[model samples]
Target: MAMDRLFAPPAERWQAVSPRLCSLRRALLTFWLGLLGLGGAIVAGVVGMWWLGAVIIVVAAAVYAFGWWLIGRNWRSWGYAERGDDLLVTHGVLFRTLVVVPYGRMQFVDVTAGPAERKFGIAKVQLHTATPATDAEIPGLTPDEAESLRDRLAALGEARAAGL
Candidate 1:
């Protein structure tokens, strides 16, 4: 199939997100939790006679907000495609990037569903490769799709390893 036919919308062509990645609800929820946790920590610190609570809270809140923004930004731009022998991940809003994971380099593939993902009927496929400290991930896939992709990747890795 042509690359365009294999991918999603043209708008998402640079970072073609999975149809399963519906919204940024997860990141928003995480941000709210982080804010609440930071507030709670500040209260606890003040109660314990620590004068740095306010400063810590301010710094923490700034960092948390930045992190939240980063997640939302990346989430909005993330997309992936499963090529014949490689997985293509395109992400980032500001510093756009594309990651290509060839079958030969993949160590293994995983299909995982967290509580939220399970509720949404989605799973994340994480591909571990020989590259140190760098793994390719494609999140927000339907359970069946995730499984199929996992099996395909595993088979490709094996085939490549066997010099097929």
Candidate 2:
């Protein structure tokens, strides 16, 4: 199968989602989760389950460290490029995955931001195609950027589909 390197020639113009994603992901995946885990451990200890509390504390620490690193790695791995006729979305650190969504194949586009994401002032854009398997998503964009991208992609898809 043909695939393009994330920053290779054709896709060299790849646009990153948002550099803030690493911090946002860290807050969501690690910070709050770590707090919860530690709280649970503390509660366990208060209930006379010292062994359980110790185990929980150890597990929480491990998860916090690993998740903190993973969040940054995952954030760095996401990138997208708009080629002439297709949108290239590539991600993953260990098992690299690249998705090329032809403009003509896009049925619709959606921009969304959850409560947590809104709090962080970031949003995501999702591209839908006739084939579910080929749909792609790009996250960690600012609200305005997400809306602009959604509109542009939708227009491009319509124009390209008309030609097909």
Candidate 3:
């Protein structure tokens, strides 16, 4: 079978994550690169190795540019779809991941937003199941969207569990 056929696309279109997620990722990347540059500068000053510092700076710049491009693709790769009895979450740039979480199997759901995520007005929804390995998460949703999804998933999970 062809690789594309291994994971066929769902009937419904995927709901993409918020674009603000790219901004959040960019901010994080910039912060980390800034720290690396600072550390390199300190080391160079202490060791009197200005050339080493320049090399580090050049490498950091290259990484930052690559990361910036990758971040957008990564953001675009993330998507979720609410099906009849399950939720589908898909993401990844190189290694694709497709998670199918049945409502009945959901033990609990959580909505979380870190300081940086909140700064970008986005949150993540995590679904826990009987086993940790099958758990699925969808990130980069607006606060309101995350709350509604959490509530809806909770209700569906309860209804399905009651049937079993």
Candidates 2 and 3, the one with greater TM-score: 3
Lowest summed lDDT across 10 adjacent residues in model 3 is found at 1-10
**What digit string (tens of lDDT, one per residue) describes model 1 on residues 1-164?**
57434334333334344544544454555667667767767787868945566666666677666776666676777777666667777666677666778888888898888887786678888999888555888887778778888898899899987883
Query: Which stretch of 10 consecutive residues in model 1 shows the poorest summed lDDT?
Result: 6-15
Off by over 4 Å in 2: 1-11
Pick by lDDT: which candidate is best? 3
Pairs of residues at least 3 apart in sequence or in different chains that clash in candidate 3: none
Instruction: Write candidate 2's Cα lDDT for 69-144 as tens digits.
Output: 8888888889888888889888888888888999999999988888878888899999999999999999999888
lDDT of 2: 0.86
The RMSD of every model to the true structure, in order and in angstroms, is 6.3, 2.7, 1.6
TM per prediction = 0.61, 0.87, 0.93
> How many residue pairs clash (N, CA or C atoms closer than 3 angstroms) in each of the candidate models, in the order given?
2, 0, 0
RMSD in angstroms between candidate 3 and the native structure over all alpha carbons: 1.6
lDDT of candidate 1 vs native?
0.71
lDDT of each: 0.71, 0.86, 0.91
Clashes of 2: 0
Best by TM-score: 3
| lDDT string, candidate 3, 13-104, tens digits | 78888999999999999999989987997799689998888888889999999999999999999988899999888899799888889999
Candidate 2 vs 3: which has more lDDT: 3
